[model samples]
Target chain A: MTGIDQTSLSRSTSLKLFGYHPVVIIVAVLLLFMPLIANDFILYQIFSWSFMLGIVALSLMFLAGYGGMVSLAQMTIAGFAGYMVAIFGVNGIASVSIGWPWWLAVPMALFLATLLGTITGALAVRTEGIYTIMITLAIAAAFFYFTNQNYAIFNGHTGINRVATPHFLGVEWRSTVPFYYLTLGFAVLCYWVTSWISRAPFGLALQGVRDNPRRMAALGFNVNAHRIAAYVYASFMASIGGILLVWGNGQISPGSVSVDVAIDNLIIAVVGGISRPIGAFIGALIYVVLRTFALDVLVAFGLDGNRFRLLIGIGFLAIVFFSPDGVIGLWNRWRNRHASVSTVRQGGAHG
Target chain B: MRRFIERHPLWSLFIIVVIFVFLWLVFATWPPGFEAIFGKKKVFLNAVLNGITLGGLYFLVASGFTLIFGLMRNVNLAHGSLYLFGGYMGFKTVAWTGSWLFSFVVAFVAAALLGIILQYLVFRRMEGQDLRQTLVTIGISIVLADLMLWIFGGDFYQIQTPDWLVGPAQMPFVTAIKSSGEAVYMTYPIVRLAIFAASVVIGLAMWLVLNRSKIGMIIRAGVDDKDMLSSMGVPIQLVFLLVFAFGAGLAGMAGVVGGTFQSISPGEDTRFLLASLVVVIVGGMGSIPGAALGALLIGLAEQLGSVYAPTYAVVLTFLIMVVVLAIRPQGLLAR
Candidate 1:
């Protein structure tokens, strides 16, 4: 073999053993063994909530990162799916439910959620930048109001409760271990899909559209169509996360899709790293952990637990002000600095 | 005929009025036994009056939004927070001083000071970047909202109106003709009329400033072309700062006015913000007249929708926005 071929083969082998990276194995092992070490609260509250919210943020990240469209309607779409589940599937409360099986209801909810997102995308695609934000925000506000007022389908302010999770083959999915694994599996699948799509031809085209829509259009790509398609994919992911969220909470209310929660989704994506897929997960983990513990930290200081949002808001502001690229960007910068410093030290030693 | 109609849009307005009259007549005579959901003609007139007052307040809030947004291309999502903050401050001032005028002035100055601080601290750092501006403003809004909630507590607060504007005013000209041909008069709150008057004065002052003053010219020019205006040696940044302060102060003043009639609550900040957005969107983003018209339309739609379909009152504004956007994306009076 040529010298180049031999070097590349060795590098590839060193990088991966048996087609699995060390990091992957470590992560897999941790995920599989996490329930063994952690209690129900940690597994359910921290991990499960983090995974679900991370999935939704990942959807926003995909659109904002790849498609350059920052949609505030993501939570609205997710809420719609949750509402769909409550309405279609058997719930403990509300006589309005259609009483459909989980198999039939889940797919239908997802499809309807996707359709709603696609319609919003199509409507908002004609606008640019701040206008897009406004339009999506308007849609979100409209959805919130509609759900809050229309007692016929949505059951008014107090949303449907006791939405049943999937149960089949003697497996109660809502249980701690099963639910944790289920959420973990979905989170992993979403992350993989996001990363895979980022490398896909369509995703590349969408990125190109994001960077320069006029140029992409000049190159014969349908910019609006690509954006709408991205919304579809993102909406599907958000729908899955929403369904998972409803199951996790055992209830879905108008509060679930409030303007604050919608804005929080954006915050999660931004604080993690808008342009990085893994950043969503990282950001969500931080947010969840902070929300869970910050109250305790505050109450200990003789402050109100409700002041948690103040801390979050301040942190968000500081993060945005100091590093607009978020935590992942900060990490990358630190790593680069370390690498450069070590290289300089090595050069000095050689001299 | 088409060319004549196109040339004179005012003629079309007249035609629209005629059509509206016809629709009213039809509604009055439809099915020969249809009863108005809004009770009698007196109630209908009262709803219309309420709508105008609400629209006037909306205009006061939205005008500032349009000015700042139009001039600087900055979307201050915290505009509503400033309003609520101002209202709370006004409420506190009234509680302390027992003077409505003092509270108004305090709210205005406080809101303006906060606006200046926001511009200097958060907005200045991320100039000309839309997404960053949005995120930063959202952050500020959250902080302000939480702080207000902590200080004001969770309860709703309303400002007490002055003694002079406390009673209802008789409206002799506004009467309902019943089937028995008896004329029934309507009376409106004097505070509502004062609010309407305030809106008119503010609107007129804004028009005069925007149209007749040199600074107004500079602001208008900046809105049209910022780089060009800056290159012409105008202090664009200073102008933007002033505009931002002025706009925020307007919101604060509106809050005081709104608080006198409507209760101030936690979520009202977002509500006013959304209202301003709808007004600006319907009225054409930066146009003063557009904001006025948009506010009126929203106010009317809201009142009418409430009278007819109380549950879907809020949806009417969204519907108007959607229809306007779909037909005229730039808004009704964009230029």
Candidate 2:
């Protein structure tokens, strides 16, 4: 191999030699050092929430980036899963209270959520572009209102509160440090799964469908079914994140499933450059960090925290208008520039 | 008869019949005696009245949406935000002036100015691009909603009703019961009546403007083929800006009237936006009368469904939309 190939191959080999990808290495290093610098409250607020959000965004990335489906129901599905866990695992009065163990409850909730997502996907996949957006939006709206009025099941608009996190291995996993690690683990697992899926045959088929759905259908692929399948899988990921999200907050509210949250998940997916799994984590980190820190910064400058949302709105608009590929695109460009410069140096040395 | 039915494609009519039968069965088996049923029916009648009022308000809001979508082919998701902004502007105007009329005027003018500026600044950049325009407008809507929340907290707000329109009006209605009972029921909100009247007037005015005027002809031409119209020496860009501003202004008026009829809250923007979308989708995109019919159908269906089948209330409008799209992808009144 040539020297350039040797360099890239050596870099790849070194990363693999350390038993992880570059993304994993970077995330691992950051996670190891983050808590040291972060306070307990900051760690819980920023790190834990970001990780949970990362999983939801990861699901959205699969739909938007790979499957080309723009769904506004990701947050609703996640929130539904959270509600299921709370209803089934904690509070038990008259609303189908099986009182299942956390293991069983979580899985059941995720499965139900996946089924719901698949239904939504089936409906949405029938349309394209703006129509798809409207159908998913309608579904999300229906869920939001359903949860609000179904007092028998979801306790009406008040929603279920005081949901205790799972006590696993004789430790309250919701404690700041434990929760941080739990979120980290979930995020990592989700990321790894997404990476595997992205490289798999199904992932390739989804990409093919997204690129040219008509052609894919002409080739005898079941486009709508594949799209629905992606939604099901993505919903499972989001539902897990939703369950973890409730655990982190120790409560589940209708506000969690509101259009704002749904739109926020969309923003995270877009901001992270909805192209890959690593992009979700990167996007989530930026969003959570900026959102958390922007409040303090705005407050310090004598602005209301509510006004911080204006800044976020501006930031989101700028990102969509300018860098539709988001932060990941910026990073890739930077990396490419460095590689090109190094190659030029290597050529000069050869001369 | 069978051949006539086949020629007419009576699927929609059949669906309507099934819905009516379902409603009849639900009412018959309702856990109340005849006397109780009468009382409940009165309540339901009140809800129907409320639904009609709400539907009129919806028509006002959705009319502008239909117009803009027809002319520009942009969904204008920010139409809802513009509505909310209009309410806020009117609220501020009310705070400024003691007169409700002045407040209404200020609200309309302020929303119109905002719409014009937005068209020039944001949408102008996104002209001819639907998806990009949608995203930008969505961002704008989110920002505007949050800004309003910041400006006016999440608390509900209502403009002060004029003395004449503040109270309920009672009209005597003679009715014979199914059983051996006779009764008269009469009750209606004057404000709701006023809203309906105003909406009809506005709708009539909009129809006239679209049909009889030279500007209306330009708008119609613009909607048909914007590129051709622009090539034909029409200032199509100016026409779009004007149409968009006019539509937004109409949405603003709808907001004030609807907000007054209902209650204006932080969430009203999104809710009304969804309702407007349902109206547009069901009515047939780009048709004023279609929006009106869609609004009335959705409003009545929503009201009845919420009372009878609460679980399906939200899905009822969408069900109609889905059926319409499946059977006639162009919608009920496709232009």
Candidate 3:
């Protein structure tokens, strides 16, 4: 809310590159041509995973930031979509897979994930604020245990392996370069949709509800409905990310949907700055980078490699302890402190 | 009780009938038809017992969670870490000294000391900020869990049962009838029953202290109005510290109990934390009796569901939480 102040937003619009920020243009161009500079491993493993995680965390950010509902079940809902895709689409496990084409399977998965998120949101809206965290956490744990133990539909711990990715328009979408572009495309689309819709009437109303539900209800808005709808929208976003996630791994497993993942997504959202959409991507990039490289980082620092989690925990603690709004908040503060002398003529894009 | 019955007559009658049926099933030996429908009486009894015993452990953990939440409005998401830490400490103590009884004291003291430090050092600085406090707890839990893992490794650890309480004890409940008409009595693990009894005693003691003691009055008053209590010359911070420590100590002892019933491992922290969350939510946050009822219902749901429908056991627990949220969002026993 503070980030959307009239001074900053109007000032941002005062300077733009033909209605788009030059920085945004530059970043887009770089990402579009990233495959030329980055290797397949970097593209597929690092960038793609970052985008997918960012999208999921973006869902969480949408709900928590605009709706004031910090639901921990977003990952579970996303995992449900991933599982739905594996079960409905072609997978190695013939017994569980329905072997539907990607066209049908993808939509089915998204719809089901949206339904799951909507149902979870409906239940979660029964409470308010922090209770949502506990309720959704319980729901997430239940979903994890259910998927982990249920062999018939979920394939238990091993999950559904060798899930066939979309091979459409004569392009292998799962390949490193192609998949990087696909994920980048989704990421850009999600970011645009989020920023665009955020100024829409629905987003305003949702933010109103977040600020004060009683006041919003008095203003003739259906509070729960807006919250639930936001969940549906966010769930759709997460479903896309989940599909990418599953496709990236070539499998969907119970381990991927564990409570740890749910918590990690929350960490990402919070660390990135739950107040903004870009924060989710930033947070996810940082988390994924640290998680991927923490072992070497720890070893380089004369510490045990297995203490990667310890480093993450300490980093998370420091982030939470110092800047509750996360890394974006820290950046905003630093920028405000140093650049306060001049009316910093800048575009709206934090990048 | 009379007021409740008169206010909700139909609900009261339904509850009475349910209780009567449950008691009948527990007390009376099943006939051939009953046995056919409900599976073997032995299996039913075992599941029921396991559920009740598990409920006892859950109550121990959740009571503190509710107490902490009820008063301080702190979610303390790291309560499960305290439990695991206590369990590890108990395991170590029992191994070093071979004294099962002394481990509880060590576990309680260790966990309570950690709780005091957290409340004083971290939580005190961020007073009245519920979300931040919860987030900090999450960070703390993550750190604690990782540290514990680094120390204890991934292997499962169960505190050694004392020799005096290591064997099964005979109970007079008839599971079946022999051809010669000799009634078969059930023999259950004595350790589980002993632990259950201990939890029951702890619960009663807590109830008595809260309801009947001077400190309890101060604590209750603080829960209602910290400013008012402080104005009234009560050391509100001290009360908060005591309550937090007590709650944490309860969770710690529960860790030992859980370690006895089921092995404690790296993942146990999350598992127990989830269980406590479910119990607290279903039972109504900040209510002790609510925690007990929620714990019992959830424990029973988990055990019976596992016995009858193994695949959907976790689903059953989830369903109970969902239903509770839907029907009584505050919880079944919330004040």
Query: Pick by lDDT: which candidate is best?
Result: 3
The TM-score values for the models, in the order shown, are: 0.93, 0.88, 0.97
Q: List the per-model TM-score of the A chain.
A: 0.92, 0.88, 0.94
Give the Cα lDDT of each candidate: 0.86, 0.78, 0.89
True-vs-predicted CA distance for residue A152, candidate 1, Å: 1.2
Per-residue alpha-carbon lDDT of model 3 for B1-335, expressed as tens digits? 99999999999999999999988887798989978887998898899999999999999999999899988999999999999999999999999998888999999999999999999999988888788889899889999999999999999998888889988998878888899999899989999999999988988888888889998888788778889899999888888899999999988988889888999999898998999999989999988888888889989999999999999999999999999899999998887
Complex DockQ per candidate? 0.44, 0.34, 0.67
Q: Could you tell me which 10 consecutive residues in candidate 2 chain A have the lowest summed lDDT?
A: A1-10
How many Å off is the CA of A163 in candidate 1?
1.7
CA RMSD, predictions in order: 5.3, 5.6, 2.5
lDDT (tens digit, per residue) of candidate 3 on A86-161:
8999999988999999999999999999999889989999998789999999989999999889999998988899
How many steric overlaps are in each model, in order? 0, 0, 0
Top-scoring candidate (TM-score): 3
Model 2, residue pairs in steric clash: none
Segments of candidate 3 deviating more than 4 angstroms: A1-7, A10-15, A341-351
Pairs that collide, model 3: none
